[model samples]
Target: MNTMFDSSNPASAPRVWEVGALCHAIGDALQARFNPVAVRGEISGFSRAASGHCYFNLKDAGGQIRCAMFRRNAEQMGFYPRDGELVEVRGRLGVYEQRGDLQLVVEQLQRAGQGAWFEQFLRLKAKLEAEGLFDTARKRPLSTMPRGIGVVTSLGAAALHDVVTALRRRVPHIPVVIVPALVQGAQAPQSLVDALQKMYLLAQSGQGQEADLAQKSPLIDCILLVRGGGSMEDLWAFNDEQLARTVVQSPVPLISGVGHETDFTIADFCADLRAPTPTAAAELVAQPRELWLGALDLLQDRLESAVQRVLDRSAQRLDLAAQRLGRPSEQLSRNHLQLARQAQRLRHAMLFKLQRMTQNQQALQAQLPQSLQRRLEQQKQGLERMDLRLQLLDPRLVLQRGYALLTDTKGKPVTQIKQAPPGAALKAQLADGAVDVVVTQPRLL
Candidate 1:
């Protein structure tokens, strides 16, 4: 490094300056003139390094300047910065010694109209809060097991892929219904409302009696409204008051997963649940299939144990009954002894009655012969008296006493003299014989 000087008028001669010293001199002048400056420009060629330092160019029609924002300052930014976005930065102007270039070291960076947007956001938030849309009591708990899931997002968004992938992995059996809509433009709020209303129609169809409507629409138990990370201006659609009101009208629980963890929107406050990311929203509605299967197995085991216990108790009761009952053979032997004693008493009574009847018949037989002999003697004496009376009146006895029996020739006895007439022949019956006779004279005497 040679130092050169002009020799004309030594005090006023130009001093020789080294390259490093000249660079230092320029840096000092910049620091004193505009050390802290605020510049508004469009960002260009912005990139973050591995060390968390951000490097970019801020440009306008007048000129462009190199800028650097360290990690500490970048973290404090409310929104992500991108190329072509108009932003205002407050920093110190300095010269880089190594490259001899002018640079700005940014201490803070914000969107060009961030203050106005922030005021609007705050006003909307306060209005909705007063209406109780953000109240915890208004928020419903998500279904533990959803029959079907409805998704509302752009068809081409990365958020759709993340949400669908998570749901399929956890609950492949459950069907998913996607209603695509714009999620970032001016029309995004109304598009989201229409998509949600379609899903609401499907949910109502399942509960109604309209079989046609139910058949045409797939039932959804819950809805997920999701979008990827973006700048505050890019995500302003979700902050719309109309979109927030539509979120509250969901028939089933609705989950809002609209940005990165650091982002917030009005829809998130009105929704039933809020998730930090799209994938997290899907996981909240789906439970793992293996977990449910484990619960079923536990219930089956409990039922089998209950049935086995009942059978064991029945067997114990049967054993106790058998112990209390005596043997059948002992009961039969006691009945047989009582029957034998009754038969013996009946046989002895029959023998005594037969003996008394036989003795009475023998006494009657001994008296019968004496009664017959007395009756025969009395009958013979009566017969003798009748015979004596008959002998006293006999006709032969009168003849033997010298009385004749006179009879006529015809053998008729003449009892009167008048019966014998003159010239009449007569027969006389003496005691020995009969004599014939004729009557000469008759007398009355």
Candidate 2:
């Protein structure tokens, strides 16, 4: 590199400088002449490098200027820098030596219409980010079922009403402790810090108004630092760097709901949780009551149905079990059939014996008269024979024929009539008739 300059001789040629030297001199002059500045322009060709550097062009109706935001300064940005968004950038004027291009090394950024105040907010955000206070690792997760919640905001702010209303609608039983504070104005920062401290003490002791409000409300599980929507200046109190640090170090997790969804603040970056609004934060902490009750009813119905099914199955089993036994009527019918068979056999045996006895009696009766007549006839014949023999011996034949029987006067037949009285009348005997002698006639001997 060489420089051409007029020598001390009069009428020397014009000065010339080497290309690098000239660029360096120009860059030095530009840096010294212009200092920290704010430029309003629309972003164009905005892109972030892999190394976390933002490269873009800030263009206006007239012209455009190149800009670069390094990783450190870019981390402080609350929203992505998109192309065509009007923005305000504050930084020093500089030149890229390698390219010899004029560019802005932006250290602060904000939406358009924000002037000095925006720059201050960015600087503070950058400072806190640099200190790692806004690190995601430092943020604690919100409790799933926090026993109690602490609120830090103005008592008169709409944000408080929104939060409390949402909480009551969702989980009315959960304890909420409010530590009132000024949400805006100069005193808001210290007031917020004091409210946070009071909630912390309430969590630790629960011996005062907080205890009375919620007798069972225990240690503060989380805190909500909220405020209604407002202008950047109105919400400036939340951007206090000290407040951000306090939120980061809170004993309980903190949720920041400082403004509308598009708005962001130091509190939002440093808090454990960030909600677009106070109501959203409340919804996040607890679920709606109706949802739980509906689930319980469904479970109860299922349980009852299951029990009924079991009972029906058991009753069916019992019916099947009872059917296994034979029917009583059938059993009795079988018993009766057996008894009838036994009775028939008994009746037949009795009839057979009675018939046999009746036959024997009839046979005896039929033979009795014949037997008696035979015996009586035999005796009568024997007597007739004897009578005939006697008649024959005594010439009874002549007597029976002539029918005469003579006897001595003594009625002695015969051989000896001596002893008979002569005066006695004689007796005659015949086979059919006999005449008796009147006298006591002695029979002839």
The numbered model that scores best in TM-score is 1
In lDDT terms, how accurate is model 2?
0.73
What's the lDDT for all of these models?
0.76, 0.73
Model 1 per-residue lDDT tens digits across residues 1-445:
8766647668868778998899899889999999789999999999989998999999999999999999998876656678998999999999888998899999988888786786688789899999999999978888887888889999999999999899889999898878789998888889988988877887777542233344344578899999998878778999899888888999999999989987888899899999998999989998987776566556445533543453344334434433443322223235334433432343344335324533653533343344333543443343334334433334455667887777666656578877888888887666676677788988775
Candidate number with greatest lDDT: 1
Task: Give the per-residue lDDT of model 2 (tens digit) for 236-319.
Answer: 889987788778778878899888886798899998989998888788877776776666556545534543454344345434
RMSD from true fold, candidate 2: 41.2
- Candidate 1 has an lDDT of 0.76
Models 1 onward score TM values of 0.51, 0.47
Task: Tell me the alpha-carbon RMSD of every candidate.
Answer: 44.7, 41.2
